[model samples]
Target: MEQHKYSISKWCTVSEEVVKRFDQVVFEGEKGDFVAFAKAYYKTNEIDYPKFFKMDALSKLAFIGSECLLMDEEFDKPTSDIALLFSNASSSLDTDLKHCESIIDKDSFYPSPAVFVYTLANICLAEVSIKHKLQSENAFFVTPSFDGDLMYTQVKYILETHRAKQVLCAWVEYLEGKYKFFGYMVGSYRQGELEHTRENIKEIYRR
Candidate 1:
């Protein structure tokens, strides 16, 4: 059996203070909350996607990360050939808390359907898929923390099994006012400077 190899072609990281693409700092946020930072990023990049304002924090974090990763690449492959796999520690807790607050009081029991829709962590994956028109295998996991081993194993399995030709894997988390997003694109061909491995992912994330 031939061993399959994959490379991380591009990667992006977004936090409350900075957004980085690969090893370069693409965007930096001023002193403000996560929401304000996200808005500033959107405006600075001139992203015209109006739906961005309506997405939950988790989705917004993932969206911005993905945007930075794909900014310089051309997507000519079939939409179904690309997969999305994302993990987060908080899962959708931030939005869930908001939802809970909306329905906490009986007298002011007003559940927002919009907020209710984002209670699931996988909704972030849906938002990315919808934006990029990706229709491949996608999954969202809630790990206690960043697990590079799990991400590498899953990406390898998908590629070896011919489930997808490319994958967008990420660890995006948003809770309270803190946020962190790290995403990378992987493929069988060597289009990146670094190999796709557990240690490499962990090292890059830590940087």
Candidate 2:
């Protein structure tokens, strides 16, 4: 396949809010209302979300953000090599806590199955794929800390195998209101930038 790297195909960015709202509908305050809070910037006097959809805030953000980026793309049947890779140091600690809290009291322990799902980082991918119909091969890895090298290798293998036309890679960690999201899409689009091998991905963050 032809390698094109330098050119950026599509790109967009969103944010965490004071509360995670679904479809602009408000959600519980504890999970990090950051995304919800950020909604204010986009909301105007004439436009506001009818209801927030916290169903899967993480994935919802990816779906909405990625789609908005590719809105004007003119690629021919573009396969979303746009793989999704997310990392969180907290590793769904909040979700686990919520679940444990549910069963902590044997007297009235009842775990909320819905909250149980967000405990895993990969759920973000599921939501993004479901929303955008992106079936590209991808992964979700967790670490005590961020290691750019680890990310580079995983992305490299995907490109080498022709499994991805591009990658929507990122670092999305959430615990309480204090969370971090660092992501970008990589692929062959530049006239000569497409040779996105392991080193290419690794070297990306070097500068």
Candidate 3:
């Protein structure tokens, strides 16, 4: 059997303060709040997605990070062949807290269907998939920390199993007032700028 090799074709990181792509700073802002930073980023880039304002912090972060990473890449394969693999430490706790607060008081209870929909961390994946028209296999994992081994293994498995021709993998987290999102595109062909390895994933994440 021929060995299959995958590479990280492109990557992007978005936080409360900056948005970076391929080790280059694409956008920076003074806002210390995650929500504010996301809005500023969308505005600065002239993004007119009305649904962006409705997303929770986690989804917003994922959407922006994925958008930045896919901005310049051309997909020759069917969108359905692109898989989405994302994980985070906090999961959807940030939105869970808000949802809890909304229903904590019965007298002043105000349950919002819109807000309730974002309680699942995987909603971020849905938002990205919807935007990019990606109808592919996807998974969301929650770990105590960023597990490079798990991510590396999963991507490799997906490729080997022919589950996907490409994978948009990311670690997007939002907790308290801090937020961090890092996304990369992976594929079997060596058309990427970075080799897809656990070490390389960690290095770009740290940057």
Candidate 4:
């Protein structure tokens, strides 16, 4: 059997105070929260997506991270050939809390479809796909922590089975006002400067 190898072609990380692409600082927030930083980053980048403001925090974080991760890469393959694999700890609890509050009061209960739509954790994946026009396989896993091994295994299978020419993997966690997003593009070994390994993934997340 031939061993298949995959590499991380590009990576991006976004925290409340900073954004880094390929280990270089691209955006720095002045000790602000994720919301403030997100808006600032959007303005600085001049992103024309109007719906970005309407998305819940989880979707916004994942969207900004994906925007940075997939930026400037012209894909030779069709958009359907890219897969999205994301995992998170809070699993949309941030939005769940709001949704719960909206319905908690029976008399005042009026759940907004906009808020209800984001109750599912996987909704972030859908938002990203819509933004990027990716008609591809996508999955969102809820884990207690970042599980790089699981991501590696899943991406490996997707690539080996020709399900996708590349996979975009991310760990996007948002709860309350805290947010962290780390995402990378995985493709053939020749496509990247670094090998796709659990260690490398952890290292990038740490950075």
In angstroms, how far off is 139's CA in candidate 3? 0.3
Write model 1 residue lDDT over 11-100, tens digit each, in one string: 889985799887689888886577788899999999888999999988999989988876665666547788899999999999999999
Candidate 2 local lDDT, 52-141, one digit each (tens):
255444544444444444434444553565677766577767667778899989999788878787777687777766555677787888
After best superposition, candidate 4 residue 74: deviation in angstroms?
A: 2.9
Quantify all predictions' global Cα lDDT against the true fold.
0.87, 0.56, 0.87, 0.89
Q: Compare candidates 1 and 3 on TM-score and give the better one.
A: 1
Q: What's the true lDDT of residue 202 in model 1?
A: 93
- Candidate 1 has which clashing residue pairs, if any? none
Estimate the TM-score of every prediction: 0.93, 0.68, 0.92, 0.93
Per-residue lDDT value at 152 in model 2:
64
Q: What is the lDDT of residue 193 in candidate 4?
A: 70
Model 4, span 1-207: residue lDDT tens: 544388889998888579988879999987857777888888999999999999999999999999998778665554887899999999989999999999999999899899999999999999888888888999999999999899989998999899999999999999998888999999998842788887888887787
Candidate 3 lDDT tens digits, 83-146:
9999999999999999999999999999888989999999999998887778899999999888
Q: Which RMSD values do the candidates have, in order? A: 2.1, 6.9, 2.4, 2.2
Error of 3 at 69 (Å): 0.8
